[model samples]
Target: MDLSAVTAALELKSYNKVADILDNLMLQVAADGVAFHNDWPYAIHLLSHFYVHDINSARFLWKTIPSSIKESKPEITAVWKIGQQLWLRNYGGVHEAIRGYEWSQELQGFISAFSELYTKEVFQLLVSAYSTISIEDAALFLGMSKDDATSYVLQQCWTVDSSSGMLTVKKQPVVTEQKLDPRKLQQLTEYVFHLEH
Candidate 1:
């Protein structure tokens, strides 16, 4: 497979195509082991997974990377730490970890793309933590203006009292029985097969 082509596609922000290529590359790597000469492929693959919010796949890739490569590249360790904090839902820790760290151009771009997702994740965490939180507090937590925080809450279908500056999450609609489509079921089966093999 052409790893450079994959890198070029990622540089162009062609995430879906990169994901498909990385999926096959990961399978090949699993069977044949890493080439050991360079670690760019692993870094690119991890960034792709992170871009798509595939935390589990990214974690798996992280664990399988050789410790030698990890030690040689301090950036890999830094990115892994960010991923670990994200998985643990410690958004504050993630912010702290990345605060003063110098990021590669590629890593900075990846973080820029991931910021919107991170904001939503932080919003969800705030909602789970409180029945009603002030917009000011939400803004502080998300590092956004109060107006932006209010807009975000309203966009998520939560109730917001502009006068009181409070946000309330509506009760989630309970799904009685989720009927999976055949295609979805097939996909799940294939995923399980991949996990087993």
Candidate 2:
């Protein structure tokens, strides 16, 4: 498989797109009856799935990876450790796994992207799930220091009570507008009128 496109995507830090590219390449190789496990970068492929927050796919991919490959390539196993943490929703473990490993230059982009995406997701969850949260928990959820988490939440207009050591989350109003297609509505109206007449 020509990895020029994959190299380009990695160079551009288009981490989300890498998984789809690899998925397509894998399909192509399978169609051609080519044995690709030896040449394929499973570690990056696994990380790419996590980068997009596709935990189920990542889990499936992990299960599909050959045991020999998993044993020989410590990096692949390390990447799966993060996947396992994500699967279990072990927020602290996620940060630890990502930070604990020395990732290659090629895979670093995906790891950074995954971390940012995970932090964003956890922030969204916090906004909807909690009106107020302790600074330490917020720090763990955001993979930041307590001071940094306080600063970050404050920037999002979340209030911090000095005495309580808790940050009040600023919930953004969810505007869900139901837009009915005018043409479809009109067609339905006409059909109703015809049936009634």
Candidate 3:
């Protein structure tokens, strides 16, 4: 397979085509029963997975990459580390990993795409972190305007107090069976066991 063509496809952001090409290449490699001899195709394929938000595929590729190549290419290693952090929903770790690195044009493009994903992820994190936060504070944390922050909270079905300028997330109450009839409990257990089988 032509690795350059794969790289060119990735540069063009043709993720679906890249995925197809990578799948074919992987099948060939598997048929030959040989380890990947080059890292560029693997790295580019991994990046394509990231572009398409296929974290499981990316993680699988990452683990397959040879450790020598990972050590030799710091940029690829950095991207993998950041990608892993993002996959794990560790947004702070993602930020820290790329904090001071000098990004190449290609790397910058990947970072831009990741940044878009980060915004959505961060919003969910913020929601989980605080039941209520001021629009101003939320905007500051997310690097958005107060209006945008307010809009975001409303979009998530959270209530915004116009008077207090705070967003309130109404947590759903957890339903637990405090008391269950023995017959009903046995019926539920049987149902679950049958379903499992």
Candidate 4:
């Protein structure tokens, strides 16, 4: 699978463009359309699942998953199980395995921010892509071009400090740097909150 596209989108966190690609891919396989599964909780669940160390955050995400969907999408259940297992991996301490070994509030905050900024449909498209994709294909996906769309995604995932690991985000648009305003920040905040609940 071509991951370049995925990676490129990741850098930018351009969900709409990413969603469009995922829509095309899902059509190929007949998987329950990614768009159908998109919602705030899924974003919260997935972002926290991938980036946060806390089990409860993931658990919260799982709980948010619709029972009907879980019943229908066994693959999703399977993937969630794998994610749970990884989250439970023994971070061996002197006494025993510590479940909280990977805990990071920073990670949690990041996810929370995403949840607020993006909607459920926005996230579903992403979740569908990640589960279905392989690194090779991800690169292939990135190789395709949508110039404006690609730029929008890449710019959001950028930062100078390596301390904050770069991941895709629902990027904010700015017509010009000088034009950025509080309203734009508020809009992004809204998108981030959409996933938090």
Best by lDDT: 2
For model 3 the TM-score comes to 0.56
For candidate 2, what is the lDDT? 0.89
Q: Write the per-residue lDDT of candidate 3 for residues 90-159, one digit (tens) a residue.
A: 6556666656466667667656665566677677778678889888877765556689878877887888
Model 2 misplaced stretches (Cα beyond 4 Å): 178-197
lDDT of 4 at 139: 24
Tell me which of candidates 2 and 3 scores higher on lDDT: 2
Instruction: Give the Cα error of residue 10 in candidate 2, in Å.
Output: 1.8
180 in model 3: Cα distance from truth in Å? 38
Candidate 3: residue 52 Cα off by (Å): 3.2
Which of 1 and 2 is ahead in lDDT? 2
Candidate 4's displacement at residue 149, Å, is 39
Candidate 4, residue 134: Cα displacement in angstroms equals: 30
* Model 1 C-alpha lDDT per residue in residues 1-197, reported as the tens digit of each score: 45776877758877646656878876786578666436456666676676677889889889888888898987878777777877886766666656546878866766666666677777767767788888877876675778887887788788888789788975455569878799999999999999999
Location of the lowest summed lDDT over 10 successive residues in candidate 3: 35-44
What tens-digit string does per-residue lDDT give for candidate 2 at 1-197? 89888889988887779989998998999999999887789999898888887888888888888899999988999999999998899988999999999998867777887888888888999999999999999999888999999998999999999898999999998899999999999999999999999
Clashing pairs in 1: none
Among all candidates shown, the one with the greatest TM-score: 2
> What is candidate 3's local distance difference test score?
0.71
Query: Over 4 Å off in model 3, which ranges?
Result: 29-36, 124-131, 134-197
Measured on C-alpha atoms, candidate 1 has an lDDT of: 0.73
The TM-score values for the models, in the order shown, are: 0.62, 0.85, 0.56, 0.26
